[model samples]
Target: MQDFLFYFLSALTLISGLMVPVSKNPVNGAMYMILCLIGTAGLFALLGSYFMAALQVLVYAGAIMVLFIFIIMLINAPAETKRKRDIPSLIAAAIAFLMLTVGFVMMAMSPELNQPMPALEDAETLAAEGAIPFDGSAKSYGFGLYGKYMLPIQVMGFLLLAAMVGVIHLSKDLHARSQAMLKVKENASE
Candidate 1:
């Protein structure tokens, strides 16, 4: 079951990731990116890192992706025209491919790359260690987050709040300037 879920989510993530860049519509691309992020979060959950999974969902999928979508909407970018691939772009892509191949070869030759995985503790042993028993309740997760990781969480919240305020200020400034220009035009007409 775990293997199935891992493969399923992994495939979904990869497909969505590819779709994000390949989709012609900016809105569709953004939506695909959000799906990719969510799929990655699901994969994280399958790996037993509940905290990471929640953080992925909360920060990347929930907040950052929404901001990206808003920015896309605000800019109202027109659909990109299909362009011919020039020789320089092809050469750059070839160089990138060669570099990746070299990196893969180096990694494969390294002994550390083939290191055996550590044995994981069973649920019974984890319970003995006083790890919070996973009762599937949100309260336990919330307690762990706010109690153990409160400082980092608060910092993230403040950063997000600052970003939100900045966006609002930029949008309002543009709107006010446009309104002022309209008023000036009206006065000039009068």
Candidate 2:
């Protein structure tokens, strides 16, 4: 039963993840991403990390995807016209695909990948000895995030803010350029 669920969730994650990149509509792509995130949460649940699974569902599948869809709605991007694929682009894509395949194969072949996890008793012993930190609760995650990982989290927040500002600036510039183009066209027409 566990194996069946693992395979099902894995397939769901993989298929939706692939569809996210392939979907032509931005909204559809975002929806696919939500599905992928949910599948990831299911995988986390299967791994017995229920807190992480809930966090994944709430933060990523819920809030982040909502933000993404909101941004897409605001942007209201026009449909992209079909363009002919060139040989150079095709070659580059093929090379990229081959590299990804080779990387996956190498990772799968690694000795460390075959190692089994410790048993439940061993994990409990390690936790009792304060070695593994596997209390398996939201408190542990919160402490790790706010205590040891504080600096990295702050840096990530700062980077995200910077990116948001950059995006807003770029959008304003694009708007100004479009207005200028419109004025020029009107003047020429007159």
Candidate 3:
């Protein structure tokens, strides 16, 4: 079941990642990117890193994606028009793909990768020995972030807030200019 899930999530991540660049509509591409992020979060979850999964979903899929879509809409990006693919470019792409495939195959067949990984130290044992255990769990991650990294987190929040305000101000200025243009055109017609 775990293997099946891993494969499913991997496929989801790959396909969504591919679609993000290939999609004709910018909004659709953003949506696909969100899916890719979500799939990545799932993969993280499968690896028992709940904190990373949550961060991936919250930061990348939710907040970042919303910001991206908002900016995309604000810019009024047009949907991509289909273009004719030239043969040379197609051949070049194929060659690049082939090279990438060969690289992966070689890496997978490397002798170093086939060796057994060293076992990790037991978290409880380390803690009992009066050493700090760096177990990658959500509880520990949250505690560390909120406890030790509080100031940095707050600073980042403020930075993001400032950015949001700036975007809003810029959008308002653009709206005002557009309104002025319409008024000028109306007066000229009369």
Candidate 1 residues 3-115, lDDT tens each?
Answer: 79989999999899989866889899989998999999998787666777888999999998898999899999778777775789778978996999899989987998876
Q: What is the lDDT, from 0 to 100, of the residue 162 in candidate 2? A: 100
Task: For candidate 1, give the lDDT of residue 119.
Answer: 38
lDDT of 3 at 67: 87
lDDT of each: 0.83, 0.87, 0.84
Predicted candidate 2 versus true structure: per-residue lDDT over 1-190, tens digit per residue: 9899999999999999989867889899999999999999999988878898999999998898999999999989897667675779878988998999899989988998967666655665566553446645888788888887899999999999999999888767787899999999999999
Report model 2's TM-score to 2 decimal places.
0.73
Query: On a 0 to 100 scale, what is the lDDT of residue 7 in model 1?
Result: 93
Q: Which stretches of candidate 2 lie over 4 Å from their true place?
A: 127-132, 150-190
Best by lDDT: 2
TM-score of each candidate structure, all chains considered together:
0.63, 0.73, 0.64
Error of 2 at 20 (Å): 1.6
| Candidate 3, residue 180: how far the Cα is off, in Å | 15
